[model samples]
Target: MSEHNEGDLFRQFVGDVKPLKQTVRGDKRPAAKDTPGLIERRRAAQELGNKEGNYLARQEHISPVKPWDLLSFKRDGVQHGVFRSLKQGKYVIDATIDLHGRTVQQARQEVFHFLRECVERDIRCATITHGKGQHRDPPALLKSCVNHWLQQMDEVLAFHSARPQQGGSGSTNVLLRKSQAQKDKNSEKFNRKTSRK
Candidate 1:
């Protein structure tokens, strides 16, 4: 065949040839021990995970903002001295978040996440501006929501509306729980000081 016909002739020759069947080489190795039991266990675990995900989805919405007494809320714990300190504006706030015009939902998430970050950084004090809401019927919706959400977190040790220059009715100053690491460090320092004396 001429060079031009050589390509078509090659294609025809190849097409006429029977194709080889592919054989999947099965493993000659021993069967995996407890294969059926393992598969069953994996299936059960996945089902349980899906069930738990659905259950958790239903239980979401920030785990419900528990009934909190805003009037008596500032005084709600064992740290009378600490609460007094917060009320008295003794703690130097290291971080501050301004929630001036944010919606209640925005404020709640910001306050929660902000407090967690403060705790992680070992920051003891923070201030949140939750708008006094002078125009609103009741007043200070963000303030009240911040108060509720703050109490819900395990990190918040104490919080009180700030002194006038610090936003007064419009903001709150917070104290975070001392992490175990800080507590241990403090105890070690105290023990050393006492031993020296």
Candidate 2:
């Protein structure tokens, strides 16, 4: 309230306030043209072919199969083997077939046709839902048939009972080879040109 007291308060406020400085000092920085340490590490990896020698050595331990080793015909001399289940997830189809209405021979034909078409169309994986043997009076006909049919098909790369959510033991997930058309289309797309900016 008094002029002396107000002057003293103003002096205290001025003494507490600090002035700002805006200059920065540092070591000379590298330009954009300079390669980082990561680049040198990558260059060294490229020179070594990123462990290709180790991969080749492992491959050498395994026996190689030749073109002549493969059967000449699609169905000729093809061995039948059961593929219990599949591990990978991305390539899978969930499909169901009604064997109840059809006869044994008819059901077999339908399954064969479906599998053939899947292979021709390049369907990598599919689920064949032949319901559980719960309702069958005798042994489960469709289940047994599907098991045998899958083994006979040459195009079936691998197959296994689907997971519980996908029908479990009642359903099978089949993996088929890509058709020639699919391979050609993929190669063509891969060989596509990019425009220069």
TM-score of each: 0.57, 0.48
Backbone clashes, candidate 2 = 2
Candidate 2 at 164: error in angstroms? 0.5
lDDT of 1 at 68: 26
Clashes of each: 0, 2
Report residue 125 deviation for candidate 2 (angstroms): 1.4
Model 1 clashing residue pairs (backbone): none
As a whole number from 0 to 100, the lDDT of residue 149 in candidate 2 is: 66
The top-ranked prediction according to lDDT is 1
- Model 1 stretches astray by more than 4 angstroms: 1-77, 137-139, 191-197
- As for candidate 2, its clashing pairs are 85-160, 93-127
For residues 1-197, could you state the per-residue lDDT of candidate 1 as single tens digits? 69879988898879778888999887675644657975575456446545543221111233322222222244356468877788888989899998765566445545655676688788998888776666664554555666657766778777777888887767778888877788899999999999999
lDDT, each prediction: 0.67, 0.56
